[model samples]
Target: MLYQLNQLRDLSSLFTRKEVKRWLKDDFKSIDIKLERYNLHKKNKGSNYLKFLKETYKILEENYPNEYILKNEFLNKWLKSELGNQNSLIINEFRTGKAIADLAMFNGVSKAFEIKTILDKEYRLSNQISEYKKIFNELYIIIPKIQINKYINYDDCIGIITYDSEVKNFELIKKAVKNEEIDSNTLIEILHTKEYLEIVYKYYGHLPEMSVFTQYEVCKNLLSKIPNQELNSLFLQIIKKRKVNNLFFNKVNNEFNQICLSLNLKDSEKNELIKKLKTNIN
Candidate 1:
């Protein structure tokens, strides 16, 4: 693994000098990391993010063999870099009531990504697929190359993104079919409490005189009553607005990205890291 040294010039805005030093020390320990020192003096030699990322990814995948390697190298880090980070909102381990999704993205339309690593089994996919359908306008199941044929035999509607470790990259094997049956319930579920209330208040009126305890219930009920086209329009509008107002969520998101970047995401370390990142940033 090697780095051009100016990697953190842009990202340093999201982290303090001390944290940046620690992070670069840990995440880039094995690599020639010059990002922090190069950017400290406010001079950017201008590194190509994708090319260096590909080089590091190639090193990690070839050297470290783990069932979850695809997740860190391809699904989380490389994919975001490839997508150009165009102010999109991405959530991992997204939950809606009982069901949890592997990854969810909000851009123009909500998209869900379900990852089934090379070591994972596909037996429980039916229930998850059903749940995701109720919420996401577009759904994709990401699987290792070995699981492609098996997953393809199960369904054709959901898109298939496959990972090939040989090349250490993702291959879009099949484009997902557009989900025509977009549910209004899922649209409301994705919105925050403030967003839901704002939409309802703007469209309907003052809350229907309910207890504050039940405001969520009332707002959800009100949202369900909105016609599909109107409700969907509101959902997209709020998503776009929130993407621009991502300052509120910047710290937490950057922590998750840091975890993936560092490649030391132990289960026990996740909560502590998030807490520390939040505390330090705030």
Candidate 2:
């Protein structure tokens, strides 16, 4: 049953250690093991099942490449290696207007990574990229080695990245061209309702008076009046200050660093996982 859970983790395309823990807890409950006992077992640090879970995940990761999961994992590691401790925000399933970006990072520049596995199709790719271009200054299509040929020019992808199974890292197959367009409308749309109002207040010193229903449209239009460069600077400032109160067990879980600031154990867990990953990759 334990190994089966690990199997399901990869097969699901997007699985996290957090979800696995929940599933494990449920399984233990079904087996009549109390949650307190399980917690106590971990507190005591001689958990054979916990050790088994780590070993099982390690073995599966080495033998099987679960397209999106491992690809995302490698990208996170690579980003950490490249970006280090720079002020940055990584968002998973980042929504810009009507489109949802697979992975997005905000730092020196706004960039997004759209992943396409062997099984994934190019059907909605045009629409996806069109929407991504609205806000993202850089866009990349991450695809497995097998699907690289199919996506080279699949739209106006700024770059293409592939997972090198042997090296266990993402290698850029094509350099992403920097996008000069910074769509303020899309950028304002990405902000929460309160944030939209806040930025507007910060810029012009007062909220635009409008009915409750017209507030969004009025706010968006007001935000558009700011020059793109100044708006870009404000966007960067606000996003960086976003508090990291959430917890993340998955080092690549998008909220990794933010949550790591509050949870030291999460940092250790991420380090341990990355350590094991390095060992296995080598």
lDDT of each: 0.58, 0.61
Give the total clashing residue pairs for model 1.
Answer: 2
lDDT per residue (tens digit) for residues 1-282 in model 1: 444334423332323334434544343321224334443222322433323333333444565324334544444444555432565666556675457876666766667788887556777788888888776677888787877778886776798888777765788787777664556666567678788888888778676787769988888788878876676667766765642222212333332343343333444454444443232110
Cα lDDT, model 1, residue 112: 77
C-alpha RMSD by candidate, in order: 10.8, 7.5
TM-score of every candidate:
0.61, 0.70
In model 2, the number of clashes is 0
lDDT by residue (tens digit), candidate 2, 1-282: 244544444434223545434443333331113214233334434433333344434554555555444544644466656532446766656798788877677887788878776557788888888898888778888777767778887665478888766666777788778776668778776787877777888899988678889999998888888887777777777776665422232454342332233232345565554343332110
Clashes of each: 2, 0
Give the candidate number with the greatest TM-score.
2
